[model samples]
Target: MTAVGAPQERAELAPLVTEPERPAPARRSPRRRGRMASWLLYAALAAVTVAFVYPFVWLVSASFKPRSEVFDNKLIPDTFTLDNYVQVWHEAPMALWLLNTVIVTVLATAAVTVSSAMVAWGFSYFRFRGRGPLFGLVLATMMLPGAVTMIPTYLIWNSLGQVGTLTPLWAQNLFGSAFYIFLLRQFFLGLPRELFEAARMDGANQWQVFTRIALPLTRPALVVTALFEFQAAWTDLMRPLIYLRDSSTFTIPRGLKAMLDQFGFGGEWHWEIVVTASVIATVPMIVLFFLGQRHFVEGIATTGSKG
Candidate 1:
């Protein structure tokens, strides 16, 4: 009788062993949220990239499109034509303009790099009276708008009989630029002082120390400065407009402007030709940037770190 009662009690308890029925909470996992956020961020970046890159793509496509399709907003043209480039080459003195640009840009870049680096070395290594104040003054000059002194600068160049020449355009940079001086000074300051001291101990004169020790170590900075100044001279329009009087002396920027001015915007618009000229003019600068890009980044990083 005891055995039978124990079996009956065990069977009754088995039915109550199951859990109460309830719904599970619908919360997202952390990994799921993170993945969603990453996707959103990528989407935003892609949109911004498209916005900036679309214009350049359109410009290149327009250069290849027929005149009737030049103004179209499509990235792929309905009809492609090389006549625009052909006309640009025939109608404009692009070769002469490119040659002039090359001369001015190279000269200006070399001069500015040398002058600015020398000035920067002085500011970094030499301890002189009012040195800080003088550097401050140089930086202050950068704050003033170019327009404020444009007329006075033009008049001064006119007095020197260089107003209608590329000499006036590049002469100012050869003296040194405030911004370039600042950039090079930061890089020079970051260099190892012990090396410079050792060179001096070995009877190295100031010029010798500068040329042999400092310059070789600061190659990255120099390349960056040269690239910057090169691009500045390459794209300068106002300076060329003010200085270059003869058509033969016009730089690429000035020549392109002349083409636009000659062809009024309307039914007679020469959009395709102008775009073609622009594409040709832009290639050199792009190539230069890519070639010096590694040094450029290193220089910026070195200067920024020390600053």
Candidate 2:
């Protein structure tokens, strides 16, 4: 009986002993192929970067070379000189041309920015009769070819006595751009309605709400719109050619054309001078783009995300 009791007690103690918890299997790291794929992607991107940048590098190199070597496919010139720059200045009124470009770009960009913002605010915030039709008309303008309206616009400006001057260049801003207005209106529509309601409840007028709340929140859109306007105005050739008759008022592109005409591709073409002028014309835009790149990226990203 004593042996039987001992055996039973041993059996009960064996049942109380539990197994320890096993650790989870370690997760396998990502495959080597994935890492190789990432490296290959980076290599492809680097090649593409070089392809885009090499042309500009060649342009600068060509600008420094003498006319005899301007067409050489060399990455670096054996000789470099500033004579081309001096000739460019002497041959044309580049200084005045640049100044005129600056004025037109600045004024047009400002007008477009302010007017677009105001129009966007109204379209986004207001509700009225024919509102849908008006907005639809604005969208329709974007579809119309700018060239189609060129003659009509010229006629209207001519009738208003604004032709042959800078007025026509900027007067279009009063109506605001269809594209920019739509861009900004989309941005405004993304804003919290409660904020506008709160402003109104606080006795804020529509103008005050726009000035204080809407404008501040929509800064990215404004910057992008302004940048676009600036670039357009800066590089515009047709408007200036049609409106400006005086050589003194020539913008950079027009002035460059005149320089090329003097050089006469038929004989003794000063390729160096032409290339140098091209470099100079492009430098300011490059600087502006790089300086504002951060804002541009932010603005475009947010606009797309919100819209």
Candidate 3:
């Protein structure tokens, strides 16, 4: 038995090694691909953010621009003037309008939040005949456009002689909005039933269970609700236009409308003042969103999680 030659031995070992199966072509690293994907996503998001934010940025810039330079589509004005803001307060009853808007927004927000929460809690906790039908009926109200009920609502307020007053602006919210009720009901339904049962066993009444336990547990939802109503009431123009006849009674939207009528179209032709007023009107809502963004996002994300 003689030993094999070196070439024969190498050839036999090469077959055993089998060329390491060609190394599978060395795929790109998953981490590198992920990084590239993330960068692209960030770039897309940045573009979208700029698109949404540019108008507002232009609005603020125009508010500082002279009347002749507004609508120039420039992001910054060559000549800056605070005169538009200063003159706006004088040209219109801005202070009074702002105060009126604040009052109405506060009233409307509080009323809707409390009323909607009550109705939602009732729907979530109570077991009764026709409960499902009643809830369905309440929800069905949302399908009807506001125009369908506006005339009848106006007549009701007119019959009560509350027309041309702030009462009509916020009073309608006392009945609990169908949308807010639905939103809050979803949150309430997600709560633990055992908590309410325990509260009852501890001799806490229904109201206590609601105020002490339910409200506290659903603070994020309530904040979301209040923020929504606040923005809605603050930006509401149609109701104010229909109900408020006097300049002194005007909310910010109504006042801005008045400014548009007086300045933007045919009155003074001082477009910068109207732009200034719009910036002022918009700033509060922007501030509010920034302040409550965390709870707003959390509440929206978690609303129907359990329900």
Candidate 4:
């Protein structure tokens, strides 16, 4: 090989010039990672909240809108009016229907709560033969389809000459609900047997023990049962439809059905009034749910945790 020139030799001997290596990216700390996860969770929750709440918000907005603009799909109304609300009261016996709903709900809720608590206390406190089998039978009743019993129930009610009034709507609740009994029984079982023994030592009767100790300790469960029954009675349309022949006896749901017939299907295109009434019907339930939300959640949590 030919000898290289001095400049070429010097150039070859020089170190190669290249870009410096970058430092590896800093690893995320646990706190940073947790913050990121929390933000993501918050964003997801906000999205779900909007998804669930937007329809109700739209309904409320529509209720305040003019008839032509009610279905315009706008969240904000260009023309706002309370005329729909005002006119709905005049068009229907809204006050009477509301009163009937309140009465029925209160009666049914009270009946079921007391009856179910009593049954639950018996199941929890009493140690007797066939107790398990008896509870199993009670639970089994829940499996029977409402449709299967509807005709028989109606016949029984008809035989008693109480089919037409609000009696059927609430009277059935005089017998403890299987599900409520089960829920409350779990709470009762979690109570220390020694507490009842102490109460007994103190000369407290079984009724006293239940009233003073069981009911107070298991208040959350009772509230849950009452709330559930209240919702059921408040929204019950089936019994009302089956028995209520007169418009004067109609509850909210039955009244709403009549209003739908009048406004939605009938010649009267007063859909705004229907929407307004819907808003009225829905607000009470929302208010109640918010009020009982803490007890509701606590009751469910405690029930699930208990035996």
lDDT of 4: 0.88
Q: What Cα-based lDDT does every candidate model obtain?
A: 0.85, 0.83, 0.89, 0.88
Candidate scoring better on lDDT of 1 and 4: 4
User: Please, what are the lDDT tens digits per residue for candidate 1 over residues 1-307?
Assistant: 1223357757666445423532232233466876888799999999999999788798889989988898887888889788988888797899999998999998899999999999999999999999999999988988999999999999999999886678987878878998889998987898889998999999999999999999999887888899878888999999999888998899999998887877535345877888889899888877887998887677667566655
Please list the residue runs of candidate 4 whose C-alpha ends up more than 4 Å from where it truly belongs after superposition. Answer: 1-40, 300-307
Q: Which ten residues in a row have the lowest lDDT in candidate 4?
A: 17-26
Give per-residue CA lDDT, model 2, range 72-135, as digits (tens): 9799887887778788888778999999888888889999999999999899999999999999
Give the C-alpha miss distance for residue 80 in model 1, angstroms: 1.9
Model 1: residues >4 Å from true position, as ranges?
Answer: 1-29, 264-267, 295-307
Please give the TM-score that candidate 4 achieves against the real structure.
0.86
Cα lDDT tens digits for candidate 3, 151-232: 9999999999999899999988998998889998988898999999999999999999999999999887889899989999
Q: What is the C-alpha RMSD of each candidate to the true structure, in Å?
A: 14.5, 13.1, 11.7, 15.2
lDDT for position 298 in model 2: 74
TM-score of each candidate?
A: 0.85, 0.83, 0.85, 0.86
Question: For residue 252, what is the lDDT in candidate 1?
Answer: 97
